[model samples]
Target: MSDFKVFPFETEKQWLKGRMIGIGGSDASAVVGLNPYKSNIELFEEKIGRKIPKDISDKPCVIYGKKAEEYIRELFKLDYPEYQVSHHEYHILQSLEYPFMQASLDGELVDQDGRKGILEIKTTNILQSMQYEKWKDRIPDNYYIQVLHYLLVTGWQFVVLRAHLNTEWGGEKRTTVKHYFIERSDVEDDLKMLLEEEKKFWEYVESGRKPPLILPEI
Candidate 1:
């Protein structure tokens, strides 16, 4: 029998590809988004068919390394805060012969107090009422594989999400934890799809073939 590996399809991969690029079609003076290199408000705005509102745009909320460390520390040591915790972001990358293979990771836990989890903290604006109730109750699809991906990177048995809720438009601050138990087989499936997509992506990069989506096949 032939031994060609099959790729596991992940919607996240298609999602990631789009984000890796620079902005798409947002006018600078009129748009409100992160001006940093990784911000793609213009491109993402085009895909979603809505102006990426300045309030909830993926602007630099917190820098991911030392700054992120300070943020976590503040969360843990703030004046009478709830659920003191710490976290960090790790870019898990398996390099090929040249460079790049499977690359993705939101954060890693070095001192989580025996908690094997990833913290996917999201901040949003509330026009009328607090929308955090939805995320508090359930970690939606956007953050599903993301949490799992962090778990896979850390080699943890399970993954949990610690979501911090805050609002720019007057809302109660809240915290919640959601758990996801993905098995070895599940992570393996994600990896296979990831590698396959990586190969195809490298091909595209070499040949200058633009791919519609670069999201992982989780």
Candidate 2:
């Protein structure tokens, strides 16, 4: 059994506060300097409540993504009927072993065989979807890291990433769903490295010290 606890938050504000108390799946990529949109320093500033606040609520992409999440989840269920999908009641989970490590899962999956796994739903535009090959074999690094972070917190053996592609083809709007399975063992080494980085990052949060900004290599 996993030492994971789920906390029910009454409001979005409370949920945000809970998220600030620990490192989350979305924050994992930023902690490792892999999120192109955010840097480790920015994440540090946000966590510490510095002057600069990064907000994504008004972003069209973010808004669309949020709106498409449930549709994507349903698509996954339709494609994999053998698996039972259940939404997290509170959605916020913490690892007892590393209380500072947290996860916000989109859904939980139980296969007919009684195996459990995590489900992550994503919405990407057609152009972005085309950049990757088969999703079952490959995924964007940032998304991959996010899933690994969730697995770390939940101690799940595997994760299913379901993505909805919103695009137009031949003068018609289309929504296509794709899914990928990620086994924890296949990325154990990578997760270990991320864990070390997260440990160091949390130290900065605890001490009110800022992590150095990572500049683009190019």
Candidate 3:
């Protein structure tokens, strides 16, 4: 099991500073060029304090997700009564083995069998068919990378991702809720790969060298 320390912050400013101290789940995808929004070079600049991270808290989608996360996590608890869910207010988990690795979990889980897992809640607005396709039969690639990073940090046994997708079909508004479970055992190789990639990216941050621009395959 990975050893971790909980870092608590009382304000958003403190949280942002805490995040800069290490690589976060959201940053993991960018490290490997899987994140659709951010590039590895951008992440490196942010980590090294060369560039200010964009503040997305004002975005409507971000605002809604923040507000809905608690409700969604609660729903998961009701949906899976056999698993106990717990959360700590404004706390971040930092790995002891890799002090530069961290995770901000939505909720932590303990199953009836006492196996530990992670609960990740996501609220997304899908406006196009392409967006829906990302969730067709599996979780989105970036999200998959994200949960794996969490697994790497916490050494947890599994992760349960609850996604709430809002979309419009036939001119009618609709919502689709789904759960994707990832077991550490099933993706040990992936976790190892992600860790190596993240370690490489952190080296770039520490050395103040920008990573080469990596684009998604066409």
Candidate 4:
């Protein structure tokens, strides 16, 4: 197996840093380095209490994500008319205690079957969580932007979340499936603006200056 462990110890901090930079529209996988420990794939399956297919991990880097993503799509009823694999490359900046950020992403998905769009895979227990509204929406922006920013970069036709509820805990035996389709122009604009701001921040970082003390628009 791979030498990766679960998200552990300083990993939470690293995850936090990556999360913050992500709000500023940085690349995903930017903070993975900070996580000295990582979760095993088995833990992922076990926690989800589902069997990850044998070939799931064998796909080419470009298509590797779909292995798990598709199962989630099928289970969640997320529309995946067709899809194309998209690869992620993180650009690291800074070297403080946690470094700038070790961001990575749900990667990108290109819908090929008239469903031309972006694919984002989410794993959460949100199924039982009550629904909230925008403006008053309590959902984390970092989480939304992870996919938003990726969509901003690629100009994909649409953005889709092929997600599953991680209900393997709480003695629950069945998993929950879900999907979110974001095909809004306003959101795309907002994400682009956010990415622009992040690019500005990156320029400062490249010049060895600390990032501005800016709070996210939660």
Candidate 5:
């Protein structure tokens, strides 16, 4: 709820370069060793310019998700009419309180009560039964860390994440869309914890010191 800054990028190159300046929502889980795809050491290396982050734009799943994002966001607006939805193209929100904290939101929301919230969209392939179970009663740990990072950066009142899960069963393809809501009031302690962890990670970056590798849970 303090002050923040909005940065606009005109090109993909600029956006990618800017991400190095801070810890982003996607980078949050990696910082805490919760992201299965990326490790804490990798994130640290990327932040310190020891390596360039891989470009996933050409990946099939990445391509599909990018193309589907706009349509899915439209569907969310139609389905959740109680909240006013809006989006800003190619802009990142940076926290003044914690300059190393940033958020690149899919969309934003304002409820009837004038409370502002975040809109996060995800598209993933559910290839196995275990993958589906991760979304059964709760958001996956990585995603929960992501939204919490967004909340920490923007200080939003709530978050609504819409996930589109694609799966194939018996040679038949199907898509299931699920929505989850998170209230900031319910996760104040989590926010505090994430902030502290992120601050420690950023310190390592600023000091040009490598942090100990944090392995993901199996």
Candidate 6:
């Protein structure tokens, strides 16, 4: 089992600052070069407090996603009546064994059998969501990495991803809900590799060294 320490903060701004102190789930994606919007070099600059021109979270899509999180969680509850879903009071968790590893989960879920797992809520435009075949089996790579990071930090056996797809149909707004269950055992090797890469990245952050930028493949 992984040991973790909860760092409770009074405000979102404080939480954001706390995140900079350690690598969180979102940062995990970038560290591993899976995040399309950000690269490892960019993350390195942010961690080292080099003034970045723009905050990705301030982007319109990201802002809308955050705003729709609550509604997405409620949708999950309504769809999965057998499961007990609860929100976490503390948004930040740091691994006691690996201080550089941390997680900020959206919520928690208890199955009908009382098995506990982490909940990750997401919102995306219909076009993006529909680009995939089945969400239950497949999700964007960056999002998958994010969830895996959470599982690694929380020592959870599994994670439930609930996504809301927004679309406009015939002048009317439509929202569709999809959920997926990802087991840690299914991605153990990948997580192990991710941990190693994150350890190296943390070293750069701690040493005030910038990591090499990952160029796009031809």
**Highest TM-score among the candidates is held by which one?**
5
Which parts of model 6 are misplaced by more than 4 Å? Answer: 56-58, 128-137, 216-218
Q: Estimate, for each residue in 21-138, the C-alpha lDDT of model 2 and write its tens digit.
A: 7789888998988887888898888888884556777899889987777777887788789889988544589999999999888889987778778999888766554454535467
- State, as a TM-score between 0 and 1, how close model 1 is to the true structure: 0.42
* TM-score list, all predictions: 0.42, 0.88, 0.96, 0.48, 0.97, 0.88
- lDDT score, candidate 2: 0.82
Expressed as tens digits, the lDDT of each residue in 23-134 for candidate 5 is: 9999999999999889989999988889988888899999999899999999998999999999987788899999889888999999999999999999999999999999
Clash count per candidate? 12, 0, 0, 16, 0, 0
Worst 10 residues of 5 by lDDT: 12-21
RMSD of each: 11.7, 2.4, 1.3, 13.3, 1.1, 2.5
Candidate that beats the other on TM-score, 1 or 2, i.e. the better one:
2
- CA displacement after TM-score superposition, residue 175 of candidate 3 (Å): 1.1
Candidate 4 lDDT over 174-215, as tens digits, reads 654555667747485766565565556455545554443443
- Which scores higher on lDDT, 5 or 6? 5
Residue 154, candidate 6: Cα error in Å is 0.6
- Choose 2 or 4, whichever is better by TM-score: 2
Q: What TM-score, to 2 decimals, does candidate 6 have? A: 0.88
Query: What does candidate 1 score in Cα RMSD to the true structure?
Result: 11.7
In candidate 6, what are the lDDT values of residues 106-218, reduced to their tens digit?
A: 88888877777899988877655455453546887888889888877887778888888677767999877777888778999988988888999999999998888766342
Runs in model 2 lying further than 4 Å from the true structure: 128-137, 169-171, 216-218
Give the true-structure RMSD of model 5. 1.1
What lDDT is reached at residue 167 by model 2?
75
Candidate 2 colliding pairs: none
Error of model 1, residue 50, in angstroms = 24
Q: How well does candidate 1 score on lDDT at residue 42?
A: 39
lDDT score, candidate 3, position 188? 92
